[model samples]
Target: MNLSIRWKVTLATLFALACGFAMAGFLAERSLERQELAQSHRNLDVRTEMVAHELRPWLRAHAPRFTDPAFQVLVRELGAKALARITLIAPDGLVLADSAVASEHLPGVENHRTRPEVEQALAQGDGSDLRASQTTGERTLYHAILLTEQDGSPSIVLRLGLPIVTLEEELSQLRRHLVLAFGSAFLVAVGLSILLARSLTKPLSDMAAAARRLADGDAAARIQITSRDEAGLLGETLNRMADELRAKIEEVSEDRSQLLAMLTSMVEGVMVLDYRGRVLQVNPALERMFNVTRAEARGRKFSDVFGHPQLALLVSTVLSTRVGQEDEILLSPSSRCLHIEASVAGGEQENEACAVLVFHDITELRRLEKIRKDFVANVSHELRTPLTSIKGYVEALLDGGKDDPDTSAKFLDIILKQSDRLNLILEDLLQLSKIESGQVLLRREPLQIEMIVERTMAMMRPLAGKKGHRLVENIPSGLPLVNGDEERLGQVLSNLLDNAIKYTPEGGSITVAARHVAPGGSPAGGKSESLEISVADTGIGIPESDRPRVFERFYRVDKARSREMGGTGLGLAIVRHIVEGHGGQVWVEGNRPCGSRFVVRLPVQPSDQAAGHPSLVPTK
Candidate 1:
C-alpha cells in the first residue's frame, strides 16, 4: 500500500509490545493463583492430619457408625478449629457429617461417597478438588484423606475444604494491576516508537534524495552527516561513491575526445548508424567521399546518405542479424570502387546497439591487381610457345634428322631464329620495367618534331622496302620546339614505325605525320601548346572493341599473325609506357579511307621532375 518506513516501524513496535504484555500477564496470573492454591492445600493437609490422628485410634478400636451423632459433632468441631468445612463419609456411601450442613439435614445431603475428593481419598489415601460446595453454595478447594484399621481395612473418609474466595480476590486484584500496567506501558511504547521512527526515517529520506540527484547526473548531491552511527557511515560511503563516479565520467569524456579526434583524422571513410538504420554520426572522410554534410545526414536513413542499394542492404543485414559483413561496391556516377566493412557496434541492450561501416577506395588497387594477373598469365603463355617450338625441332634433329647435313643445318638456323625472338622479348620486358619503375630518367630539351620524325622514317625505310612499300613523312617546316626526353621520344616513334612496317601489305604505304593539338582534345591547325604525332599503315585495322586495350602489355587481336611476323607483342606496350613517361597519351583509331592510325600527343613542356634529372641532348 506504499506505506512509509516510519509507519511500518511504529506499528510493528506497538504490536510486539501488545503481544508481550498479554502473554506475560496471563502467565503471571496463572503462576500466582497456583501458588495460593498450593498454600491453601498445605493448610488443609495439616487439618486433615490432625483430624486423621484423632480418628485413627477410634477407627482401630471399632468400626464406627456414621449415624452416631457423636461422630457428627466431632466433624463440625474439627472444621471450626481448622477454620474450614469438614466432612465425614461412611464407607457405605453415607454422608455421615458435613460441617456446613445442619445435623437434621445431614441425611438429606447428597451421598458424599460419590464426591470426587471422597472417591479419590478412598482409592488413594489423599485427594483434592475445587468446586462449588453443595450445602453452602460457595466455591471451595477441598482436600480429603481415608482412615484405616491396623489390618488395612478402610473405615471412614475425612475431608477438609476451604473456600477459595481470598485467592480469587487476590487474582482479581493482580489482573487489575496488570491491565493498568499494560495500558501505561502501551502508551509509553507508542510515544517512544514514534520518536525512533522519525530518527531513523529522516536520515534515510535525505539519503534517498541524494541518490536521486546522483542518478540525474548531479555530482554534488550528498547526505549531511549528523552522527557517527551506521546511518552516518552510509552517508560517507555514498559521498565517496559520488566522487569516484565524477572522476570516472571525466576520464570517459577525455577518452571520447581522443577517439573522436582519431576517427576524424583517419583516411578510411567511417560512418555509424543507429538501431533503426538512421545515421548517428559520420566522420569527415565519409562526408567528403559521399559529398554529404553531417547536418544533412544526421537523423536520416542510411539509404539516404548512401544511395547505393548494395551498401544499404549490407547495413540492414548487420543491424538485423548482428553479424559482420564486407563487400566491394561500385559507387556509381563517379564509378569509384570501395571496399566496405559493416559490423554491429556494442551495447548492453539490443535496442541500443548500432552499425559501423568503414569504406576504403580500392579502385587503383583493383586495377593494379588485374594488371599483375594478366601480365603473369600472358607471359607464361608467350614464353611457353617459343620454348615448345625449340624443344620439338631440337628433338626432331636428335631423333635421326642430324644424320642428314642439310636437315641438321636448317634445324640449327630455325633454333637460332627462335633464340633471337626470346632474347628480343626479354629485352623489351626489361626496358618496359625500367621506364615504368622511374629508373629510366628523362632528358628534356627543346627539339623539333619535324626533324625527329624525319630521322625515324629514314631509319625505318629499309624495313619498309622489304614489303614493297615506301615510308612517307608529313611534317610542316619550322615546327615548334618540343620539350621532352629525345631518346624516349625517339623510342616511341621507332616502335610505332616498326609496327606499321610489319603489319602493312605489299605495295601498301606507311606515313609518319606530325601536327598540333589544343588541350581541349581537338586538333589545331596553327602552333599550339601540344604536338600530335600519327603512325598510319594500310594493314589489318584493330577492331573498335579491342582499341581500348591495344596498349596493354602482350595484348593482341591476332596472336598467331603477330608471332609469325617476329613481333614480341611488347612493342605497343613499350610505346605506351614511353609516351606516358614523357607526360603524353597514346591511342589507336581507324585511319581515314583505309587503315588503322596510332596517335601520340605530347606537351610542349615537361613536368619539373624532367628538369631535376640529368638531361640527354639529341645526337646530330
Candidate 2:
C-alpha cells in the first residue's frame, strides 16, 4: 500500500499508453478494412464493365438466346480470371447466364429480375449490392449496369458480383499486422514510461530521503541530484535549508552552553519563575542558598521552595508591574539576611513574561555592622566615664580647692587615678585590637608549666594575702612543658589568679594546679600531648548564662564591683586572645563547694627538655 512514487507513475503511464495503443490499433484496422473494401468494389466494377461490353454484342445479336454456349463460355472465362460471380439477366426478369452455374444447372436457376442489384440497375442505370447469391447460395457483391445498343436504346441489364470473402481475408491479414505493430508499440511505450517515471522520481526520492535524514538530526544530509529541473531546484533548496538549520542549531547550542556556564559560576543565587509564579529553573547557587535541590524545587511554587514570603511577594509584584524590584529579606531555618532583586525577563506580552530573582547572602555584613555599632557605643561610654571623673575633679579644684593644699592635693590625686584608669583602658583596648587583628607576633617556645604558674602565683600571692585568702599550688611535678610565648603564658596565669583573688572573700581558698594530659584526654585530639592549668577559688561564681560572654571585650558580670576593685573588664578578654593565639583553649567552670574555676589547655612540646624541669610544688 505504501507504493513509491516511481512505481505509481510508471503504472499510471503504462495504463494510459496501453489504452491509446489499443484505440489506435482499432482505428487503423477499421481504416484498412474500408480501404480494402473500396478497392474490391472498384475491381468488381471494372470487371462488370468489361463483361458487359463483351455481352453487349451477344445481347444485340441474339437478344433472346440467354442459354447460348458462346455467352456461357465467355462469362466462365471472365469470372475465372476476376475471381468473382457473374450473372446476366434479360429485361423480362428471366435468367440469361450465371458464371458460377453449370450449363445443365443454368436452366434451373431462379429469375434474377427482382434482385436488389438488378432492380437498382434498371432504375438508375447502375448499382451494387452485397448479399447471398440466389444461384450459388454464397455471400457475394453484385454490381449491375443497364446495357445500351449502338442507337442508344437500353437492351439488357448487365450485373456483376464478386464474393466479399476475398476482401474480408485481406482485411483480416491487415488487422493481424496492425495488432502486432500496436502490441509492439505498447510494449515499447511501457518501457519508455518506466524510464521517464524513474528519471523524474529518482531525484525527488533522493531529496525526500535527505529531508528525512535532516529531520532525524543528520546535519550533513544532502541530495546529490544535478539536473536543471524543478526536482533539482527543490533538492538544492532543501540542502540550503539544512545548512542554515545546522548553523542556527550550533549557534543556539553554543549560546546555551555559555549561558549555563555563566549561571553556574555566579556567586549570587538566581531563580527563574513562570507567569504563574512557579519555579522554572534554579541555579546551583540558588539551590545551596535556599537549602533545596533543583529536582525538589522544579515545578513547585517559588514561595514553597524558598520559604520566604517577602521574596515571593516581590516576585509577584515584579511580574504584575513589569518592573524590577529589590528588597532585603531574612530567610528562615538558617536566618540568613539576603538582598533579593526580582525583575520581569521575557517578551512584552504578560503571558510570555517570566520573573527572574537574584539574591546574595548578607548575613556576615549585617553582623559586622551591628558589632561596629556596639563597639562605638561601648568605647564612648568607657571614655566618657573616666573623662567625667577628671572633669568633675578639675571643676572642684577650680572652685577654690586650690587655695587649700590638702584639698588641692587630694583633687589632683583623684584626677591622676582617673587618668591612669583611662590610660589602662586605652592600653588594654590597643592590646586586644592587636591580638584580634593578628598583628601581635607570638614568641613560640617550650616553657615549664609550673614555672609560669609559680611566677603568676608569686605576683598574685600578696594580693590574695591582703584579702586573707589561702593560696594553694597543686601542680604535678612531671607536668609537660607547653609550647607558647613564655611572657604571654605568664600573663594568662596572672590574670586568672588576679580575678580569683579579687572575687574571693576573706578565709576563702585559692588553688593553682597543672597536669600533663594525653592526646585522647585533651579536647584537641590526635596524637598530640597537652598541659592543662586551672585557677580555682571559693568566690561568687559566674552564672552559666554569663560564662560564654565573659571573655568578650569589656564584658563584665559585676560591672560596678569590677570598677570599684580597679578592674578594666578587659583582662579576661586579653587572656583569651593570648591563649588562642598560641593555639590553646581557655574556659571557665563552677568550682567545687561554691566558686568558679578557669581552665587553660595548651599543646605540649615533644622535646626532652620538658621532662627535666624542677616542680614548683608537690601534686596535691
Give the RMSD in angstroms, all C-alphas superposed, for model 1: 10.1
Query: Would you list the C-alpha lDDT of every candidate in the order shown?
Result: 0.83, 0.82
**Candidate number of the best lDDT:** 1
Clashes of each: 0, 0
The per-residue C-alpha lDDT of model 1 at residue 500 equals: 85
Candidates in order, TM-scores: namely 0.58, 0.64
- The residue-by-residue lDDT of candidate 1 on 272-310, one tens digit each, is 887888888888988888889999998887887677888
Local accuracy of candidate 2 as per-residue lDDT tens digits, 1-620: 88889999999988887788778878877887678778878998888878776766766776556567877888889888767777777777776777778878866877887888888888898888877876667777788888867765556777777878876777788778878887888788888988999899989888888888888988889899689789888888888888888999999999999999999999899888888777888889988887889999888877777656777678778878878898999877688899987877865433343878888888998987876786687778788988999999899988989999999999999999999999999998998888788777777566778888778888888888898999999987877667667777888888888889888888899999888778788655646777888889999999999999898777789888888877888899889888887777889999877899998988887676555543231111
Clashes of 1: 0
- Which ten contiguous residues of candidate 1 have the minimum total lDDT? 611-620
Model 2 poorest ten-residue lDDT run: 611-620
* Pairs of residues clashing in candidate 1: none
lDDT against true structure, model 1: 0.83
Residue 620's lDDT in candidate 2: 11
